[model samples]
Target: MKLTCIAVDDEPLALGLVCSFIEQTPFLELKGRSSSAVEALKLLNDEVIDVIFLDIQMPDLNGIELARVLDARASKPRIVFTTAYNQFALEGYKVDALDYLLKPFNYEEFLRAAQKALNYKELINKPAVAEAKSEDEYLFIKVEYQLVRVALSDILYIEGLKDYVKIWLASAPKPLLSLTSLKALEERLPARRFMRVHRSFIVSLDQINSVTRNTLHIGDINISVGEQYKDAFNGFISKWN
Candidate 1:
C-alpha cells in the first residue's frame, strides 16, 4: 500500500533531507512539506495524509500540541516526531506518536521511523477496511470502481498478480478482478476458513476437494503447495482428518 506523507520542520535543511528520503522510498508518497505545525494543518485539511514527519520544537504551534489536535479528529494521520530533544519521548508516546526520530539521524534511521508509521497505519486501518463482514458471511471488495459483494462460501480461491488479485467464485463464470495486493487481502480473510497454499494462491479450505503429494485439488483444478507453506498446509490437513 502507498502511504501519503508530509514533512514538517522549522529547519530548511532538515525538511529538505526528510523530503528527499520520502521521495526515494517506494511505498511512500510525499504530499507536501511545511515549515510549521500550523502550515501542516492547512495541508492536512486539503489532503488525506497517511503519515506526518513532524518536528516537536516549532514556533506558534508545537508538534506535540498539533498531534493532540489531530488526535481529536475522526480520521487522523499517524505522527512520527523528528526532534533534537530526547526529553519529549515520553510525552510523544503519551500522545500515541508512532515513532521518535532524534536529530542527526541518518537515512537508515529515518527509514526505520517511516516504516514504523507505515505499519501503524496498516494496523489502524485493517478493522476499518471494507474487506470483511462476519455477520453476513460476505465481503465487499472494490472491483473496477464498484464495491462488489461476494459470499464467503462461494469463494473458490484467490489468485495474486503483481499489483492486483483475481477472486474466483464458485457461482460466477468469470473471476472478479480487484486492485489490491495478496498480503493486504490475506490479512482480512478468516484464518479458519482460508489458507495460503502458495505465494500466488489463497484457497478456501472448505472448497478443497482433495490433496495428493504437493498438489491440492479444488474440483478439477490443481494448485501446487509452496515449499515455505507446506508445513502449515500439512498441519491444517492433519487437523482436518
Candidate 2:
C-alpha cells in the first residue's frame, strides 16, 4: 500500500531535502510541503495525510507544539520528527512519533523512517473480518475500502497471500481478495466447518469433493495438506472409517 506524506520544515534546504526523499521512495507519495508548523496544519486540515516529516524548530508554532495538537486529534497522521537539534527526541516519542531522523541524514536514514511509517500504517489499517451474526451463516470481508458479505457455506477454500487472502467460493468463478491474514480469518471461522490444512490454506470440510493421499479436491481444484497438519488430518479422516 502507498502512504501519502507531507514534509514540514522551516528552512528551505531542509524542506526541499525531505520532499525530495519522499519523492524518491516508491511506496511514499509527497502530498505537500510546508515551511512552518502553521502552514503544515493548514495543509493537514485540507488533505488526508498519512505521515508527517516535521522539524521541531519553527517560528510561532514550532514542530513540538504542532505535534501536540495532532496527537490530541482522533485521526491524526503519524509523525516523524526531523530537526537539527537532538534534544527534542524524548518529547517526540511522548506523542508516539514513528521514528526520529536527525538533520543532515542520508537517503538510508530517510528510507528507514519511511519504512517504519509503512509498517505502522499497515499494522493499524489492515482490513478486519468479523462474523455477521450469532449463527455464523455469513461474514464480512473487507475488500479494498468496502466490507463485502459472503455466505459461510459458499466458501470452498481460502488461499492466503502475503498480508492478504483470496476466498474461493461455490457461487463465483473468481476468488474474493481481501487485505487480512490467514490466521485472523481462521480465528473467525467455525471450527467444525472450516479447517486449516496448511499454513497458506484453509478449506471447507463440507465442500470437499474427494480426498486423495495427501490432497483434497474442492470445487475444481486440489489443495495439498501441509506436513505439519498431516496427523491431524489423518485423525479427522479416521472418523469417516
Candidate 3:
C-alpha cells in the first residue's frame, strides 16, 4: 500500500529536497508541504497522513513541540525528524519518532527511513502479516538516480560519516553511499553475520581475512575495534576460533 506523506520544514530548500525525494519513491505519496509547524497542524487536521518528514527547528512551533501535539491525537502519523543537529535524537525517540534523520540526507537514506516507518506502521496495523514474514535478506538502496539491489552476503563492512553510511562491498571497488546511520544499518543486518567492531564500523564476519589484537583485516582493508565494542568483538572472535 502507498503511504500518504507530508513534509514540514521552515526552510524552503529543505522542504523542496524532501518533496523531491518523496516523488522518487513509488510507495510514498507526497500529500503536502508546509513551511511551519502551524501550517502542518492544519494539514494534519484535514488530511489522512501516514508519515511526516519533519524538521526539528522551526519558528513559533518547533517539530518536537508539534510532535507532542500530534501525540495527543488518537490517529497520529509516524514521524521522521530531519535536522542538522544530532543532539535532539534522544528527545525524538522519547516522542516515539520512527527515525531521526540528519540534514543534507540523500535519497537512499531517505528511502531507508521511509521504508522503516512504513514497516513499523504495518506491524502495528497488521501484526499477523508482519510476523509471518522472514527476515529481509536484501535491500534496494537508491544510489544517485538509480536503485541498486544489495545482497546481504556481498557486504564487507559499513562505515558511518556524520550523516551518511558507506557500504563497502567484497566485489565492488567503490563503496555504496547512503544517507543513514551505522546504528540503523546494524539493526537491519543479521546479528549472526554482522557485528559492530567500532562506533563507525560494522563488519561482515564472512569477509574477515585476519585479526590481530584490536584490528581486523577484511581483504586489504583494516578496521579497528573501538573500546566500547572491544568486548563484543573479542567474544565473536573467540567463538569463531
Candidate 4:
C-alpha cells in the first residue's frame, strides 16, 4: 500500500527537496507540503497522513513540539525527522520517530528512511491472525538510534527521569535506558501485569517481593509509593488482602 505523507521544513529549498523525494519514491504519496509546523499541523488534521518528513529545527512551534502534539492524538503519523544537526537526534526518540535524515544526506539515505516508514505501515496494517495473542508479551523501545526489544516477563521494574527511563530487568545487572517519558511508557504497558505505584517507579506485579504502607520491595530495591498514585496501589493491595 502507498503511504501518504506531508513534507515539512522551514527552508524553501529543503521543503522542495523533500517534496521532490516523496514524489520520486514509488510507495510514498505526497499529500501536502508546508514550511511551518503550525500549517503542517492543520494539514495533518485535515488528512489521514501515514508519515511526516519533518525538519526538526523550525521557527515558532518546531518539529519536536509538533511531534508531541500529534502524539497526544488517537491517530498520528510516523515521523521521519529531517535536520542538519546531529545534536537534535536524541530529541526525536522522545517522540518515537520512525527514522531521521541527517542534513546534506543523499537521496539514498532519504529513500532508506522512506522504506522504513513503509515497512512500519505494512506491519501495522497487517491483518491479525486468529491465533494472535490478545496481549503483547514484549515491547520495543527506542534506545538512542536503535529499537531494543524487551520481554515483559524479564522486566522487574522501571525508573523514570523525566525525558528518559531506565528499565531494570531480571536478566541483566545494568538497567536499559531509553529516551521516552514514563507516562508514555505507562500507557503502553499492560495494566494487569504492571502498575505505577510511584511517580518515579513502575513495578512488575509478578516481580514484587513485598509491599508495605509506603514502600515496595522488588528484590533488594526499595521503591516508595507516591502519594498521587496511592489509591491505585491500595486497590492492588486490597486484591491480596
Q: Best-fitting candidate, measured by TM-score?
A: 4
The candidate maximizing lDDT is 4
Clashes of each: 0, 0, 0, 0
- Candidate 1 overall lDDT versus native: 0.88
Candidate 3's C-alpha runs over 4 A off are: 127-241
In candidate 1, position 93 carries an lDDT of: 68
Residues 137-186, candidate 3: write the lDDT tens digits: 66655453234668878999999999778998877899998766889888
Regions more than 4 Å wrong, model 4: 10-13, 34-47, 57-74, 90-96, 128-136, 140-148, 171-174, 179-188, 195-199, 208-241
After superposition, the stretches of candidate 2 with alpha carbons farther than 4 Å from their true spots are 130-241
How high is the CA lDDT of each candidate model?
0.88, 0.86, 0.86, 0.88
- Stretches of candidate 1 off by over 4 Å are 127-241
TM-score of the candidate numbered 1?
0.53
Error of 2 at 47 (Å): 0.4
Writing each residue's lDDT as its tens digit, candidate 4 over 70-177 gives 999998899999999888877787688988789988899999888878767776666676214523687877776455668999999999996789999999999999
Model 3 root-mean-square deviation = 8.1
lDDT tens digits, residue span 77-114, model 2 = 98888989889876776566777888799999889888
* Ranking of models by lDDT: 4, 1, 2, 3
lDDT of candidate 1 over 1-241, digit per residue (tens):
8899999999999999999999999999999999999999999999999999999999999999999999999999988889999999877866767778899899998888777767655644676444233424877675642346688899999999987799999998889987788888898788989999999999999999999999999998899999999999999999877
